[model samples]
Target chain A: MPDDSLSRMSLIEISGAIARREVSSMEVVRNNLEQLEEQGESLNCVARLFPEEALADAELADQELSSGNSRGPLHGVPLTHKDMFYRKGKISACGSKICEKYLPSVTATALLKLDQAGALDIGRLNMVEFAYGLTGHNEITGDVQNPLSLNHIPGGSSSGPAAAVGAFLSYGSLGSDTGGSIRFPASCCGLVGIKPTYGRVSRFGAMPLSFSLDHIGPLTRTVTDCALLTQIISGADTNDPTSLNHKKTDYLENIDSGINGIKIGIPATYFDEKVHPEVLREINKSRDVFRSLGANIVEIDLPDNFEVCNSMANIITASEGSSAHAKWLKEKPEDYGSQTRERLMSGLFFSSVDYLDALKLRNVILQEFLQDVFSKVDILHAPVVPIPVPTLAESDIQSNPGFIEYLMLLGHCTRPFDYLGLPAITVPAGQTDNGLPTGFQLVTPPLEEALLFQAARAYEKENSWFFPVLNDN
Target chain B: MSNQWSDFIERNIDVPEVKSALKSAKNHSDIKQNYICLVPFEAEPSGFSKVISTWKLKQEQTEDQNA
Candidate 1:
């Protein structure tokens, strides 16, 4: 197979091809490394490259396969992760100057699980400073360019993972979402991403932005690839007490299960008011696609006053995030990028009572949202962003009060889900008038990830991701 | 320290800590606190994961009953 062709294959496809000996592991690794060094520069998606290390691992993987020993499902398949996931003693900068040389004592459990599943770690991708920002603008490490158009924002915090997978530097990646980080970036890059149920995946070693809302999951070009990665890394972990204790659902097994009777909910009031007509146009098309797929589309009015969840979520996030960085904010105030430092500082403004109210309200709102929406349909679908993908220059929220509206608009569509602690997935729906790709988000009842994947797969079969055309362009 | 000070920061306006504080404070005011039953007596704060697990259990039992 051609080098780029090998790189373009989905994670599961690459795994199967490597197992079949059609393309050697070394060939796949080498191609990606070349792509990372040559064409990957303009995108600024990579923070560091482990060329020699990756190649040696790939060679070893090939030898093991040649000896008739398969490591596991992802055997020899290359993957990348957000820098926040530590591999003990390595520099997991997390797009912050404060941790430019900081080394972690323990490796993230998610990384350990991926290693056991036989994925080759290629490099750490760029992200917003400490995974705090929304537009992937890291003053510390430079911006991660959108794969579709380098000029547009690669929705961020999980900026690097989305860009890397979208650019074919890695077949898939692990990204953590606190408030729309994973879903936003993946949607911007026109890939599928899931912010699994809050406790569905382990957060044992990943850096904490907001403990209550943090979730780790996958981003990939195809829905099945996302499903496979989510499966391998999910399960109870002794190290993270909060990790879900439920039996793992084999996401890939019934992934192809037709959504024949699935009732998908479309918002009637909230999102329509916030979204641009062109962006709404794309999401409406996805709704129509679901309708044509023999699935029912029900109109859902967001549970009354549930919009307060967004503000309440903000209180919790600022309170928790401030606590996480309190020491750093005091000592190394100059170390943080202005944007990240200030975002952390906002947490100081929320009192303990405010934090408690947000926490208590979270349960009340979540129980209400589930009963109100899920009783009507199996899932809820909405636009990821109010407008088409914005250019990097316009989204510069650092001290430019003018661009603050862009930041608010982006968060309005995402923050509520984190507050509700439900599982949300974003899949490329179509492109907007500016020729930039836009995605629609589908939210499911807690622990209903399989249904989310099944529904997304049904959509994927009809409207494939928008990244392939980026290569042709 | 103040909402204006924090809001002056790059992204705080999006988070709007002051708005959240005031809204939550009003809901927690003494008058309504007595009447409104703020939370369930036995409920823990941020037991979202437990809620999800309970939800999953209910789903499974319902499926079994139908079968």
Candidate 2:
């Protein structure tokens, strides 16, 4: 196969080709690095590139493959990690200057797992500073331009991961989610991201913004790829106390199971209110597709504390983030990005009572949510973002105090799941009339990622939607 | 307010002393209700479990037969 063709193949396809010895790991890595060089400038996805080390690793992988010792699907696949994930000996700037030269002495469990699975780390990708913002703007490292449209925001926190995957610079990428960091960028970039159930994946060495809500998952071109990646990374880790003790199951096995007679709940009130018309239309289109696939679409109402749940997430995130960065704030406050510093500083203003109240309210809301929604529906469907990808100029963070409010609103349908610690998956439903991609979120009860992927796969396969053009690719 | 809560408040906010003052002064009873109940809701878990399990079993059986 041609180098370009090898670079363009999906994670599963690349693994198959490698297993058959049709391609060498070095060849695949070289192709992907070449693609990265050709497309990385326009996408602005990579924050750090280590081509020399990557080639050496690829050579080693090729030797292993020749010896009939393979590391399964991820072995020899070229992938990247979000800049925030700690990789020992690699500079993890977290897209900020405060830790510009800081290299961790330990590797994140997520990165270690992927490495053990035979994935070659190409480089670190850019992200919102400390994973705070959602607009993919970084004052220190420069904003990551969207591959689909240079003028648009590439959705943040996991911005580079999504942009890289969407641009075919990498087969798969790891992104951490507190709010919709992983899924939001994935949706904006027209990729698939799963914010697995809290504790489903370990966060041991990941830089923390909000410990209570952080989840690690993958961004890939297809839901099956997400499943494959998730299977390799997820499980109990002794390093992370919060990691679950659940048995690991084959995620790719039931991905194509039809959604026949599946009960999908649509929140009648909360999701329908104040949503952009274009977004609503796309969601309805997805619903129509699901209905045609024998899904039982049922209308349901959100919990009594739904709005409070949104507020609680904000409070907890801000407070916990401020506490986490206290030392850096005290010493190198000027080193941080203006927006990230401002947001983290704002968290420092919440009274301890307020923080505790937020936690108390979180418990109350989760209890109410479990009693209400999770018990009834197999999965809850909603728009990942109420609005399409807005231009970078429109969301001027300097003048607008409402920027965070608007961001929270865009994450309104998603934050509740974070607060409840439920598993959610976002997949491309279709595009708006103007051709911007929109995603439908499928949220399920805790640790039911298989069901969410099942429904997502069914919907994705049923409607073969067109992918957004990668400008100048 | 207690010392632990006071310490927690101090560490999180920018003006920790101000927050401590506010927490001490503000009445706990002044808590406002921000909850919005959509409707009376009930969940039938038994029915939901049965449906999901049956679906899984059918799927496995179909795969087995194909094999």
Candidate 3:
């Protein structure tokens, strides 16, 4: 295989090749490193690369695989993750000035799972500062540029993860989603990403932005790759039973069962209020693809929280996020980016009662959602972001005059599922008029991720992957 | 949002420390008051997991009945 073709293969495809000995893990790692060294700087998406460690591991993986040893499905596969997952003796800067020199003492449970599954961790990628901001603006590490176009923002906190996986630098990556971190970046970059049901994956040792809302999941080139990665990382983690106690299910068994007669709901309210015309056009096209796939797409009324869940999600994230950064915010406030500082400061002002009330209100919103929406449809389909890929100039919090509204606006569609702790996945809809791709979300009630994969698989089987054609610079 | 929360949220919003996130803080205060009345008296801050488990049980029971 040519170096570029090996780099372009999906996670599942590459792993299968490695299993068959058609390609060696070392060759794959070297191919990935070639791109990581060349295009990585231009895209501005890398936090740190571990070429030495990754190549050494890949050599060992090839040796072991030749001797008939395999760790798991991801064995000998190369991968990367957003900068926040803690790995002892490694600097997890988390795209912030506060932790620029911070060395973690423990490896995150999810990262450990990946290691045990025999995946090579080649690097940590750029992310929102402390995974707090939505758009990929991290002043500490320069802004993560969208791989498709330097002018557009790589929808973030999982910005680099999405960019790398979307650009095929790594077959897949693990990213945390508090609000839309994983899905938004996946949508903007035209990849498949899952923000698993909140408890589906263990969050122990990963950077905590919002303890309740944060979900550690994967972003990949296709639905099968996503299912494969999600299956490996998900299980009840004893160390994080408080947050990660959901039992794991075999995700791939019925993923190709197809969405025959599956009731996929198109929201009649709330979801379409601010969608871009071009994005809506693409969403309609996606609806057509689903219709052809034997899935029943029905217009269903989504339970309206009157933007109550929206504000409450903000409260919980800001409150918990601020609490996590309280000491640093007080003593080294200047270290944080302006937008990151401003957002954390807002968290301090919310009273204890207000925070408690937000938590209480969470269940109220969730129950209403279960009965009013999920009872009618196996999944709900909506646009990931209400607009096309934003230009960095437009989403720049320090420069954009509508920065506050922009922050809230972009997180609008994905925030509900984040706080509701439901399973939501983003699949590429199509490229908009501007040529930047966007995705539509398919959400299921908590713990119903298998259904989401089945539906997304049906759509993807009809639609080819929407990867960007990068010109050789 | 329930209508009975008019008397709530007497917290200080004019404080300069919050001026940076004034819009968000104020929005949270308003929304908190608007929605808190809807939370049943029996709800606890850590009860979210229980709520999901109960919801899942109910869903499974319904599916079993249908089957």
Each model's iRMS: 5.7, 9.7, 3.9
Q: DockQ score for model 3, please?
A: 0.40
Enumerate residue pairs that collide in model 3. Answer: none
Query: Candidate 1, residues A200-293: lDDT per residue as tens digits?
Result: 8999999999998889999999888889899999888999888878898888888888899889888887787888899888899999999999
Clashes of each: 0, 5, 0
Give the Cα-based TM-score of candidate 2 against the true structure. 0.87
- Ranking under TM-score, best-scoring first? 3, 1, 2
Clashes of 2: 5
- Taking all chains together, the TM-score of candidate 3 against the true structure is 0.94
Tell me each candidate's RMSD, in Å, in order.
Answer: 4.5, 6.3, 4.6
| Candidate 1, superposed: residue stretches over 4 Å from native | A402-405, A465-473, B1-43
Candidate 2 C-alpha lDDT tens digits along B1-67: 4543456455655554334323422322133134322212332212322332333356457789999
Residues A344-405 of candidate 3 have per-residue lDDT tens digits of 87787787788888888888888888888888888999999889998988778662345666
What lDDT score belongs to each candidate, Candidate 1 first?
0.82, 0.78, 0.84
Q: Model 1, B61: alpha-carbon shift in Å?
A: 0.9
Report the candidate with higher TM-score, 2 versus 3. 3
The candidates, ranked best first by DockQ, are 3, 1, 2
